[model samples]
Target: MIGVGKIKQYSNVLDKPLSKGKQEVSLSAFAFLFSELVQYNQTQVDNIAELERRLEDAGYAVGARVLELLCHRDKGNRRETRLLGILSFVHSTVWKVLFGKVADSLEKGTEHEDEYMISEKELLVNRFISIPKDMGTFNCGAFVAGIVRGVLDGAGFPAVVTAHFVPVEGQHRPRTTILIKFAEEVLRREARLG
Candidate 1:
């Protein structure tokens, strides 16, 4: 069919084997594409929440694919099984691959038993974005949160992920913290297994 041939032509690049050498892209090109994605999603939604949800949904798809490919590339085709193991993978490997560096800090929630946090001084997605004052408490890092949520859910750990901006006085850049809250059943299961 004509459609089938066209689809194959468009997707042929994806069929290529992964090479050992690093695959690099222009950061400016990515920033342009990402900005356009945000602008398009912004025009479709009435509220900040809806716009962020759309962005997150888009990131979720990318994260799902990245999880599979990165697991194969870095873990020798093995998948992480434990909560800590997956957290470490995300904090180190995923951050490195996505941002060209690891996150600033990974911390357990002090009050909550099922909550974890990953803090980045300058989130990659937010580096070029400037939220208008009218947008209220909007943070573009929600897209990254969605990516983390997708990766966890795909790895059999269903959780909610939220991104918050925490500004530090005397600091040049604000911090973005991604909070991950696992379901009660997941925590219970971990306890039972241990």
Candidate 2:
């Protein structure tokens, strides 16, 4: 069973009933707060890479906690070991827990057995992110990539996660895909264990 205490804490913080399985929130509020956070972190860091790494660290903490909550929510199911299985768990379980919906798609990298992807529409951070011409290298999705990395790491995957914006042909909004690449040792161990 899910941790009743944690769920109750979330409800109390959000100031709403806890029995409901889900709730709606204002995206504007989230966007503004996230922007401010990014800006604040920017001031504390030396360069773009460092700034991104800091944001990812923040997301990593959230990811670790989220993984615990989700596992409890699912009645403590054994953690996934296979590459495909864990990737699916991240796309559906982790995505839903964080964003209130499953990712739009989950795919494997054709060229790499260790690489996986989770794509989503309407990424929360990028919804209002506008990069100025002077700062053409900014991407707010690094936080999300960090979260994915944290989740996978907490689950023993030890992978690198990168977030990219891929525009769908007909979709007005860009699709954000989080590419996860497992370390070589992890893949080798899996093979040996199997």
Candidate 3:
């Protein structure tokens, strides 16, 4: 397998250890790279949702692999089995490892029992993105939502995760919220486990 940063190759994929996704990449640099991804995807699709889906698909795979590697490396192969425990893991552990900070909040949805939201004041992926009028509600945060979905799905919790930008009363920019709605079976399983 070919390694990305150091250009090392391994006979077997497992021969090379998976490193943390964390890097010293600057915000502007990463933004440019992500923009390239968006631009390339834009050329492949005709609509904003399709573009977001393509980006999310990319992120889902990444989130799954990140979950596997990080959990194994940091948590010693054990995984979260409960809903709240897994939510906490994603909100605090995953965010910290990938973005260098914990999410601003992980709140249970007031109207729904199986719904949860992860809010970030300045999600790294969305920091430098400026939405044009044509795109409407398109957000690069969809990729991050894909990541969260991948992590949750990998951990045995199937959820419908989507990214949305919410307006803050006095803030210059809106906050990014990742909404997670777990499947009924998953919620039932959690109840049984509890």
Candidate 4:
């Protein structure tokens, strides 16, 4: 678990005047830093997938710690366990805690009993991501996916989260949909209990 003092310090940094009421930070800054991060990880890894995975893992660690702190501060306790309940918590409370807004949409997969989707446009970190042709496999969406996974796992969801880019017809910015598929045991246990 992350310490309370650290979380508060980080939040305060984000709330600085430069953040401007937390409206949004500079895309250029995020992009440049993220690009450098990716490049640095690339040197440490053998392939593109590994580099992306490293980024995702890093995001997941942050998410886990953030979730813990948020729950501690707001709920004065821990988080929920029910699938739909925790998903809602992640979509609204967790989203706001991290990105300052609720997700655009949250839906369960009609076709898959164990799957749910959390969709959002204007993903904070990916606002300026422009993947080059050579780096076709690169997608900053994985970071968000890792976040979802971390939060859910912290709340005992035990799910696999994947981030996808799905652009709406009129939306200029890319929309990211995080697909979460719960482990079979979770669904079975929920069904048995309910």
Highest lDDT, which number? Answer: 3
lDDT of 2 by residue, 1-194 (tens): 35866654443554553233545667788888898989999899988788878888888998888777777667354677777777788888788767788888888889989888888786778878876666555567889988889878988989988877787898875688888899998999899988
User: lDDT for each of the candidates?
Assistant: 0.88, 0.80, 0.91, 0.79
Could you tell me every candidate's TM-score relative to the true structure?
Answer: 0.88, 0.81, 0.87, 0.79
Clashing pairs in 4: none
Per-residue alpha-carbon lDDT of model 4 for 33-113, expressed as tens digits? 877877788799987788778888977997898788777667757677687888888899888867778999999899999
Prediction 4 global C-alpha lDDT: 0.79
lDDT of 2 at 134: 67
User: After superposing candidate 4, which stretches have Cα over 4 Å from the reference?
Assistant: 1-32
Give me the displacement of residue 148 in model 3, in angstroms: 0.2
Report the lDDT of model 2 for residue 4: 66
For candidate 2, give the lDDT: 0.80
lDDT of 3 at 40: 95
Lowest lDDT block of 10, candidate 1: 1-10
- 127 Cα displacement, candidate 2 (Å): 1.1
Q: Rank the candidates by TM-score, best first.
A: 1, 3, 2, 4
lDDT of 3 by residue, 90-140 (tens): 999889878988999999999999999999998898877789988899889
Q: What's the ranking of the predictions by lDDT, best on top?
A: 3, 1, 2, 4
List the candidate 1 regions with Cα displacement exceeding 4 Å.
1-17
Residue 65 in candidate 2, Cα distance off native in Å: 0.4
